[model samples]
Target: MTFPTPSSLVFRQLFESESSTFTYLIADRTHPNEAVLIDPVDSTVERDAKLIKELGLGLKFGLNTHCHADHITGTNLLRAKFPSMKSAISENAGSKADVLLKDNQTIEVGQFVLECRATPGHTDGCMSFLLKDQQQNPLAVFTGDALLIRGCGRTDFQQGSAASLYNSVHTRLFSLPDNVSVYPAHDYRGFTSSTIGEEKVHNPRLSKSADEFKTIMDNLNLPKPKLIDVAVPANINCGVH
Candidate 1:
């Protein structure tokens, strides 16, 4: 599923089936040698590395939107494969990384610049990365788990707060232009992406009032993630342990 991206940018969305996680590969077409990978899964490092190498791209950063509990990150493994690559995550994520980012920070690779927005809900360190075109118009947003296709991430643990998530979506994410595409970290419903306008009107959870959203989240009764016990601790150390 390809979203409409600018001709100046090279983009690919890779999936890891075990966790249903989506890893994004983005680079400036003018500087294909420098590329960024977001939300890479540990098990698919080889696959990602091969793609990067095949494209003749020099992996610059292995970025995680938050400290994931469902799967270990591939940042460490990516660094091992591409020695110059750096691992990055939100400073508030309570995770170790080569670069600890903050809200509103910008990471530039060639002509592409990613604006980081702190959107904590599923976890205290969750972030969303926004890309803009030459005219400064928003192109797309990589929403780590704050907002999904039709639903949102579970806020039952890891300092998850339903109210906070609700506020983040309404204030930070929903504020973007309706045409801006939304790419989430994980999707269970086979959805690849959605538009801001689509989510605003159609999202079952986020479209509701704050109190109603909270009530819905509270009654979900979802099971704990299978990998939480091992994945969380390993991710804190950048997924090497």
Candidate 2:
């Protein structure tokens, strides 16, 4: 689902590079004042804070697609700022998230409705948020780290699995409209975003079928994140780790 002009909701994309993570803010016009921040960056809360104030929007929600390994998330911080704002994450992800988003669960706020997709494999409860207008046509998807522009997320971290990622991508994310704009959790090479169709045609990983993806992911070796050990435990414990 592609749109001709601005989307039904107002969305802003931000990139934080201590770990190269991408954060997004999605809001609708009717409640143009109520906004949602996704996979917020801990190191850049002040920057986000600045943007929120500049945009003159009240943060209504904060979400994490999954527990992060490279950088701490600002989910708790944002919730603290907006005491009533709900913090969302997948169930049993060992998170302090307040709203446990389940598969196919829908959230209606103002003119936008977001559908929760239980896209695990990157982690036990990794999720992707599917957005649409009142018509239910596909608009955008915030794919935390489950999918990237030309590459899929690494499956070597805690709770990470090559097989799980393949299924999550092949069946879950890939099923969306090929033209849907993808906003990923991070991009290693600095390219901002890409569509699923673009990835399918150009992504080295997606060029292979499911079976081929599993085999290649299994044999490939990737270096651990520079701060994985330090970032993850803290992320799980509200920055206490």
Candidate 3:
């Protein structure tokens, strides 16, 4: 479903099928060509770069929500392609990045600003980016793996904690306005996006009591990610080869 956006906002959600990852490109159309890319995948950096160039956008930052274990991030490659662009990640993630973001830290892309919210539990350093309009009304949130459409990131690895994830979502994310759009990093199912109100009611896992949520997470029995070993190490260094 399409979320209503301001006419001056340039937004694109690109997907990488192998990992089922969603990469977002956000920019201000009224500004002088500045843009930022969130949760970029290594395999799709070329495509992202081509699109940025074609759109005449000067990439300002390649940001990750956390250190991903399923796939390498495109931040390193993006920096290589666009020398002026910087790589950013949460400071708690213990990863190498040009900018180590803190909770509540704001990153500007021309006239637009993205506020980083510390939403760990999926990982020690997981973050969600909140984009607001000029008047400070919530527009959309890039939830990364912390929260998903009708689901959430598994709390089985990467310093995962069910209690922490539960708290993060309830306090940091659920508090947003009901109309704020939710954009997650990955989607195994066909869903693309959901709103805070929709997930609060329809999300099977997060909508349950905290104790129930933790119990469910502990028993998920999901298999290990295929690329954990390689992806984790590469991602720790900001996806450098």
Candidate 4:
């Protein structure tokens, strides 16, 4: 396939079928060979690596949106392959990431810079990565589990608070331009993307008032993730024993 213009970005949305996880690969077309992977799954490392090689891109960083409860991250494995490539996660996550990303901290990928936005609540350290064009216009926001297409992440566990999640979404994500694309970490349905405007009005759980949102979240009574017992601990140590 042809690449994008030098001033643009090369973007790919990869998936891990088992966990319904979405991993994003983003690179600056000006330096097409340098890239970053977000929310990578341990089971998909080989596939991700092969795809990176085929695209002639060097994996420069492995970033986790948060400490996931469903699957272990591929950060350590990617770092093993590319020692210089950093591993990053939100400081609140308490993961052993090479870089503890804070709100507004910038990460470089070729000529593209990813700005971290603190979007906790689904998890204490959840983050959303925002990318802007040279004109400083909104491009896309990688909303981990914090913000989904028509729904939001479950706030029943992992130090989650529905009130905090509601506040974060409104103040941090909904405040963005209406057109900014939203790429979430996982989607149970077949949806590929959504826009901030869509979620603002359509998100069943979070679009409601904070009090209503909390009531809904509190009553979800959802079952815990099947892998939480194993995944949580492994993820804390970057998936290493």
lDDT of 3: 0.92
Query: What is the TM-score of candidate 1?
Result: 0.98
Stretches of candidate 1 exceeding 4 Å from the true structure: 1-3
lDDT of 2 by residue, 15-37 (tens): 89778888988777668556888
**lDDT tens digits, residues 79-100, model 1?**
9899999999999999999999
TM-score of each: 0.98, 0.92, 0.98, 0.95
User: TM-score ranking from best to worst?
Assistant: 3, 1, 4, 2
Positional deviation of residue 5's Cα in model 4 after best superposition, in angstroms: 8.6
Query: Would you list the rank order by lDDT, best first?
Result: 1, 3, 4, 2
Give the clash count for each candidate. 0, 0, 0, 0
Question: What lDDT score goes with residue 12 in model 4?
Answer: 89
What C-alpha lDDT values do all the predictions have? 0.93, 0.79, 0.92, 0.88
Candidate 3 collision pairs: none
Residue 70, candidate 4: alpha-carbon lDDT:
95
Model 3 regions more than 4 Å off: none
Worst 10 residues of 2 by lDDT: 1-10
